[model samples]
Target: MNFRNPVRRALVAALGALTVLGASSLHAQEIKERNLRFAFSLAKEHPLGVGAQKFADAVAQKSGGKMKVTLFPNAVLGSDPQNLSAVRGGTLDFTSMATGLVASIDKRFMVFDLPFLFNDAKEAYAIADGPVGKGLLDDLSAHGVIGLGIWDLGFRNMTNSKRPITKAEDLQGLKIRVIASPIFIDLFTTLGANPVPMTFGEVYGALESKAIDGQDNPVAVIESAKFAEVQKYLSLTRHVYTGMPFMMSKKTWDSMSDAERNVIRAAAEEAKQEERKVTAAKEGQSVETLKKSMQVNEVSPAEVARLREKVQPVTDKFSKEVGDATFQQVSAELARLRTASK
Candidate 1:
C-alpha cells in the first residue's frame, strides 16, 4: 500500500523470499529417502547384475543420495516364481526374470519364447522397444506389478551332456531341462526331446546328478552358470530370443511420489540399455570361453530351417494362446524391420 516508502519495499521483498523458500521446501519434500531391494538369479558379474548395480547407483545419484537399492544376485532371495510372487505382494520391490516365466502370468509373453522367433538380437530389440512390447508391459498393471522395460538376455541355445545337436534328430530321447513354462515344454517336446520342466536354480545340480541329461540357455548364461563343467555340448541353436522384463511391485509404485516415480522410470531405462550392451559384448566371448570345456557346434542354416518346420505345430498352438491380434502385430513389426534392413 505504501510503494513510495523504502520500508514498505523492503517488507515486500522479504515476503517474496519467504514464498520462494517455502516452495523449495515443498519440492524437496516430494522426494523422501527410500531404500529398495532388487533380486535376480544370475551371478553378480552377469550383465543383468551389472545393470542392477548401475540402476541402484543411478537412483542414488538422481535422488541426491536419498534413495538406495540393494542387489541380491544368485537367487539368494529365491527362484524366479517365488521372487515374482514377492514383488507382486509388495514384500519385494524389484526383480527381473526371463519372459518365459512371465508367461505364467500372461500367455501373450510366450510370443518371445517361440522357437526361431527372432533372426538376431537387432530384430528382437526392435519388437521389444516398439509399441507391441509397450502394450504387453502396460497390461502387467492388472497383475499388481509395474513393467519398467524389456532388458536383453540374448538368444537361447541348446547344451547337453549327451551329444552335439547338429540336427533336430539329435535331441531325440535326450532329457533336457527347460523353464517351467508350457511354451518351453512344448518346444522341446516337439523337437523330439523329453522336456523336463524345472527352475533355473535347480538345473546345475540336476545335470551334475544326471537327473537331466542337458539344458539350454544363452551362451552368456551357460558360461556364467558354469554349465560347461557338467555339460559336454553347446549347440548354437539361437532358437528363442529371451528378454528380461524389469518390474516393480505395484504396491511399492503406488506408495511413491511423482518425483520418485520419475526417478525410477529413468533409472530403469538407463539400466536396460546398459544391460543390453554388456550382454552383446559378452556373448561372443562367452561362446569362445565355453569351447575350452565343452564341445561347441553351430546348427547349419538348412538344419535350423528344418528345426523351424518341426516346431511349427507348437508355434501355431501357442500363437492361438497369445491371441491373433498380438501375434499378427508382432509379425507385422518383424516384417517391417526385415524389409527395412534389406
Candidate 2:
C-alpha cells in the first residue's frame, strides 16, 4: 500500500466514526430532562385535578422521561385569579383555570360561559376544538399566555337553601354566589336574582353562613366540596357548560423547542378527552350522591325553556360588550357544530 494513501484512509475512517457518534449523542440529548410545574384550583378528587394528573402522566410517557410535570392541586399554589397572574408574570410555568378568570384578560373568553350556548358536552368540545377556539387561543398570546386546549369542568347547576329553582321566576330574590365574571353577573341579574361574585375558596363559607343563599357549580364540584351539607336543594339547571383552559406562560412556551411544544400539545389534547369521559360519568354519580343528602330537583324541559327565554337578552348584552364580530363568529361556529352533530 502507498504510505500516503493508507494515512489518508485511516484519517477518513476515524472522522466518519466520530461523526456517527456525535449524531447519536445529539439524538439522545434532544430528549433532555425538563420539569414543568402546573397549578390548578380544584382538589385532587375533582375532574380538573384528575385531568391534570393524566396530562402529567402523558407528557412523561410521550417525552420518554425527558419532560416531567408536577401538579399543584387544591389551590395549593393559589386561587385561579392569583395563579393566572403568576403565570403571566412568568413566576409559574403552567396552569388550568376556569375561563371566568381568563375572561378578565380577554372578554371574548366569556363566550364559553354564555348560558345555554352549548347544547351538550360534545357540542362544547366541537366548538372549542375548532376555529373559534383556536382564534381565542391566539388572542391570549397578547396577554402573556398560550391556551393549549379546553379541559372539562362539566356543566353548571344551581343549589340553594331557599328552595328549588324550577324556572326563571324561581331564581328571583335568591342571592346566588357566582364567579367574578361579568356574564354570570349579567345572567343572574337579568333573571331577577342577586348575583354575588366571589372567589371559589369563599363560596362554601358564604353559603353556610347564609351570607349567600346559593351558588352554581357542576354536580361533581358541589359533591366534592360537600355543599350539600349547607345547601338544601339541588336544581339541575345546567345553566352553563363550564370548561377550563390548559394555559402556559408565554415566556416558558417561547423557550420550548418545537419538538417539546408538540409533545405538550398532544398531551393536553389527550388529557382533554380523558377529562370529558370522566366528567360525564362523574356528573350523574355526583347527583345520586347529592340526592341522598339533600333534595334534588330536576327542572322539566318546559321550565328550562322558560329560563332560556329569560336569559336570551343577557346573551345579547354580553355579545355587545364582548364585541359583535367575535360573538357572531363564536355563534356561527357553534351553530355549524350543532348542525353537524345532529
Candidate 3:
C-alpha cells in the first residue's frame, strides 16, 4: 500500500543483479563439456596441424577448459575421404581437407582445383573471403557438412624422382602420384604424365619404394613430408591454388549450444589466419631446405604457360559440371581483383 515492503524490494533488486550476471556469463549449463576429435591427413608440423592446434587451444581457453579438441593428424583417424565420411556419419566431429578431395563428395568443390584459377594468395583470399568462397562453404550444409571457412593450402608444386621439370614436356612419361581426383588425373595425363591416383597417407612409402615416380604438393608439404629424402627434384610448378576447408559434421554441430558454436566459428577463423602465416613464413625456407637434399627448379613462365594450356580441357569439362554460372561468377571476381591491383 503506502510503501512496498523491504523484503519485496530486496527480492526484486537481487533478481535484477542475478539476471545481469547470467547474461554476461559464458559458462552456460546448456553447454555440456565435450572431448571432440578433429582429424587431418597432414603431419603434426604441417600448417594444417598448426592451425588445428590453434583452434583446439582457443576452444579450450574460451570454454574455460570445459570443451577440448583432440587432433588426430597424419591420417591416424583415417584418410581425408574416410574422415569426411566419418564426420557425415557422426562418428567424427570435424576434419580439414583440400577442396579438391571434397569435390568427390560434390563436384562443385572442384572449382577450387581448376588450373591457374588464382594467380596469388591475395587474389585467392579475396575470392574466398568474399561471396564466392562463402557461397561454396554454404553449399555444404545440404550434404550434412558445415564449412567453418577456407584456409590456405598454398600454391601446389611438383616433386619427383625424375629430372627437374624445365618445361611442360618434362612431365611426359613420368609416373606421377596424384590425389585420387578427376582433375588431377586429367591434368597430369593431358601433360603426358602417367597419373597414379593414391591416398596421401600412402604417398611416402610409394615414393620411397619407387612405386611412383613423383607427386605434386605445396612447398611446405614437400618439406614437411620429407619427400626430399626419397625424391630428387622439386619443380616450382605452382600449378594450382588449393584451399583447405574446415568442415564440421551437422550432427556434431547440432549437439552444441549457440555459445559453443560461436566460440568454434571464431576459433576457426583465427586459426585460418594463423595457418596462412605459417605457410607463408615457411614457403621460402622450405625451398631452401629442400635444395640442400633435393634438386629444386623453377619452371619458366613459358613452360608454365604451356602447362596451363595443356590443362585447359580438364578445366573446361569441369566448368560445365561446376555450372557455368558459378564458374563465371568467380572468374569475374578474379578479373576484378587483378584489374584493381593493376
User: Which lDDT values do the candidates have, in the order given?
Assistant: 0.92, 0.87, 0.89
Q: Model 2: runs farther than 4 Å from truth?
A: 1-24
Stretches of candidate 1 off by over 4 Å are 1-24
The numbered model that scores best in lDDT is 1
* Local accuracy of candidate 3 as per-residue lDDT tens digits, 1-342: 323898888888899999988976745665668999999999989988999999999989887788899999999978999999999898999899988898887787788899988888988888788897898898888888999998888999998897999898888899999998898898899999999999999999999999999999999998899899999988998999889989999999988899889889988899999999998888998889888999888988988898888888988998888888789988999888888888
Model 2 C-alpha lDDT per residue in residues 1-342, reported as the tens digit of each score: 453798888988898999999986775566668888898877788888888889999999988878999999878888889999999989898898777778899988888888888888888887788887888888898999989888888889999999888878888899999899989998999999999998887888898899999999999999988899899999998989887988999998888877788888899889888888889999889998999999998999998888889899988888787788778887887777667767
Model 3, runs deviating above 4 Å:
1-16, 24-27
Error of 3 at 61 (Å): 1.3
How well does candidate 1 match the true structure, expressed as C-alpha RMSD? 2.4
lDDT by residue for model 1 (80-180), tens: 99999999999999999999999889899989888888989988888889998899899998999999999988898988988899999999999999999
lDDT of 2: 0.87
TM-score of each: 0.94, 0.90, 0.94
Report how far residue 257 has shifted in candidate 2, in Å.
2.1
